[model samples]
Target: MKAISLFSGGGGMDFAARSLGIDVLFANDVIPETELTFASSFPETDFHLEDIRQISKFPSVDLVTGGYPCQSFSLGGNRNPANDPRTFLFKEFARVVDTVKPKYFVAENVSGLKSIQDGNWLKLQLDTYNEIAGVGYNIATAVVNARDYGVPQRRKRVIIVGVRKDLGVYYHFPKPTHAKPDIAAKKGLLPYASHGEAIRHLPLDVPGEYYERPHDPEGNFSWYYMSRNRKASWLEPSYTIVANFRHTTLHPASPTMKLLWSNLADGWKQKWEFSSEYEHLLHDPTLPVLEKPRRLSWREAALIQTFPEGYEPAGKLEKKFEQIGNAVPPMLMRAILQQIVSGEGLLQFPSEHEQYLTVGKQLSLLSEEQDIEPIES
Candidate 1:
């Protein structure tokens, strides 16, 4: 199968597609740093450094895959649920699908997209792409966690799959290949990959020939960031890695922040303090004080995201973190694409036409309920 990749940050999806023998004809992203990283990694692909709305033509292929920008709908960002221009970018995705008419299309976004504006945004997105090129598509959406797919981060994302109606196939998402240790034996699955296991062998203090050096923010933590525990145990998966380097998960070697107390009157406002176990070292002039708590290095973040070994992201430190955080974990993408191509999780629909009609009706009612309308582009 051939594919065209949009919003292709650091080629994570492209990497997975290639691993599965899917020929990616073209990849595009507006960020110059992403272009540098993607081109270096996928020199054979036609990498376009331009906005998606500016590009009017796309190569025809069997599949189209992209994890479009999700900031406006993400819980991490300002949720302008009603009229954020970025919110309408999915229409461009639909436009491409309509133009190329691929056999299948996969769109991914933050899990927060479902609850934005009480799901009106998701409904409008689905209704927009429900029927393209007149043949229509049987779309299925599911929320998947990266840990379940062997990635050492507990990141959750919404995966949307669409099969052209003429194919008459119901796409079933891939089941979890891994589970928490306690339930793994019962479910006959492998144990979840641990944060320690992912980066235990890498150099911690100094930069090696292949991996970058570890570093943390230089100043005090923000009130918003300090409100919750940022440290994960070595035995568990790391927290979600955000695009901003300053907000990435803390290294597990450091003690978890101590929660002093919570005030019930002010929305349960809490106070957090750094562990004082190492404070004695600060007082001793002869002994070396411990370095401040550091975040996962750029290479460490990529490792936890399951990027291939030795895959170096191009550009400065900030850009590297952004690309890695924004990327779809290759392992997660591979699991889904494998199921789509192999029909391993294929399901049979009793009445395909009726199902399609029902989906359309639900989307319509959802639009009416929320009184939220999609912006015209």
Candidate 2:
């Protein structure tokens, strides 16, 4: 099927849909940096580097997908402030959808969209879609965590799927493949993937520090893992991969690692500087400085979001993170696309090998005994 991606930041949604054999006919974004990356990655696809509101043209396709800007709707933002202009971009998405009339459409946003002032803002947004599309759209909403789709990240986002009313069927969200603490780890199942599992094999190319120097020997693991900290829970998936790298530190031995600060008394700063060894890791001048390199590399962040390795992003490093951080996890997108294509849900399973899930559980149990608090959301 053919597809068009709007607000296509670094084309994460595009990559996922394309990986599932969907033909991405058109990709649009207003940011030049993102457009460059999208163009480089999708050389064959038509890319529009203009505002969706100003675009006078659009392609008819089987699907229209986008994760519209959520700053206004995000909990970290203005708490779904109706006044924020970014929130209105959803209307632009709807406008194009109405004109092009794709068979299916998917919109993604932060989970906070559901809880803003008790969902009053979300209701208005949905009502607007209903009004614009005029009822042929069978809309369903679900909060999806990337880890459920084999992403090593625990990132959660709200996903909305709409099928043309004429299709005569409702779309179901993809099922979770990984086991949670509340659920038993099913063997012979797809073992829950981990942060280490996802990026372990990929070559590490640190920011502004390429592998070209004589002394810069290539290694099998990231410097982040050099401290040999115990792995956290593998079965439950990882926490979100935000733009800030300092938020990436959850390793027990890495005192420079900053856990997410939830409460005022969490002592985040102290924890970030508990040991001289870890403090040095945080101050490593080689690390990227946008948010903090303590989190993850841009490439690592892309992997957590399920972008395949060797995918070259366009623009500067910080721009790359901006595009990557805003992207949809491609693995989750793949599941969504599969459901759309097959008209049925895919089956998930536990693996007979069981080692992958078991090791993760064991490590998580050990960390809990040590009282290692997980990074905050």
Candidate 3:
């Protein structure tokens, strides 16, 4: 089936759908840099640089996907999505859904949205979708962790899926594929993948200091790790790639020694040391010391987000991070796409009883692994 992506930051949703063999006929985003990246990577798809509000007509497609701006709804940010003008951007999404009337729609945002003003605000958000789409739309929401789907980072997002009501079948959320900390320890199972596993093998140079002209630019490695220490491993997943670039330093003792040294001399040492000590105090775990505020080359950041290593982003440095940080991780999106295309019906709205059952199962599993009682909130 075909899809159209709105608020398409660097085309994460588009990438996921395409990987699942779904065609993205059109995409729209306001950022010029993102539009450029989308154009370069998705040459076959039409990309428009326009405000979502200005798009009077949305293209007809089987699906619509987007992650509206969440700055207003994010926990770390001001919890003012309802009153912030940016939150109304969802209305534009709804407008497109109403105009295009796609078979399905997926909206993603930060999890803080669920607890906005103790759920009252969330209700209004849902009500808007229901009203705009009408009763035939079967809508469901879930708080999904990317780590549960094999992503190294512990990023949690709220996913809202809406299927045309006439389909009759409810959708269920995708099952978790990675083991939690307790499960890994108790069962002697492999822990969830770490950032190192994702991108360690690439040849490293100075962090964020690109070779003026690569000897084998096209044939050379696309990205490399940039950690605080030289001994840090790359075989695991990565830390969250936050919008604040200063926090992107790799672990100390990362295998990428050259990059670590470069970061240390360039003023990442103090921040890195502080973070390392803080983490040690909290967890008492053995970890290498590293420098902090080490910049991740744009290419590396894209890879951590699961974009192909060579996928060149459009625009300036700041613009690139904005797009990347705002994107849905493609790996997570891929799992969602698999559920939809396989007709797994794995996106169902659970009744209270079903939710209770699921929670019970989860708690039991956690208790078994942690050797402690599970406390329900």
On TM-score, the candidate that comes out on top is 1
lDDT over C-alpha atoms for residue 116 of model 3: 69
| Candidate numbers, best lDDT first, in rank order | 1, 3, 2
Q: Which of the predicted structures, 2 or 3, would earn the higher lDDT when compared with the native?
A: 3
Q: What is the TM-score of each candidate against the true structure?
A: 0.84, 0.74, 0.75
Lowest summed lDDT window (length 10), candidate 3: 368-377
What TM-score, to 2 decimals, does candidate 2 have?
0.74
Q: How many residue pairs clash in each candidate at the backbone level? A: 0, 13, 33
Runs of candidate 3 exceeding 4 Å displacement: 133-135, 181-190, 207-237, 249-293, 346-377
Write down the lDDT of every candidate, Cα atoms only: 0.76, 0.64, 0.65
Candidate 1's C-alpha runs over 4 A off are: 206-220, 260-271, 276-292, 350-357, 360-377
- Between prediction 1 and prediction 3, which has the larger TM-score? 1
Say what the RMSD of model 3 is.
Answer: 8.8
Expressed as tens digits, the lDDT of each residue in 1-377 for candidate 3 is 99988898888888899989999998898877876787789988988899877778656798989898888888778887657898788888888888888878898988777666665555565676777645446666667777667776657787777777777655566666666566757754446776644554454455543222238542222133223232223434555666644345443233232321234456534211222333422333444333432345556667778877677677666667777777898998888778779988544454331122222232222111221121111
lDDT, residue 349, candidate 3: 52
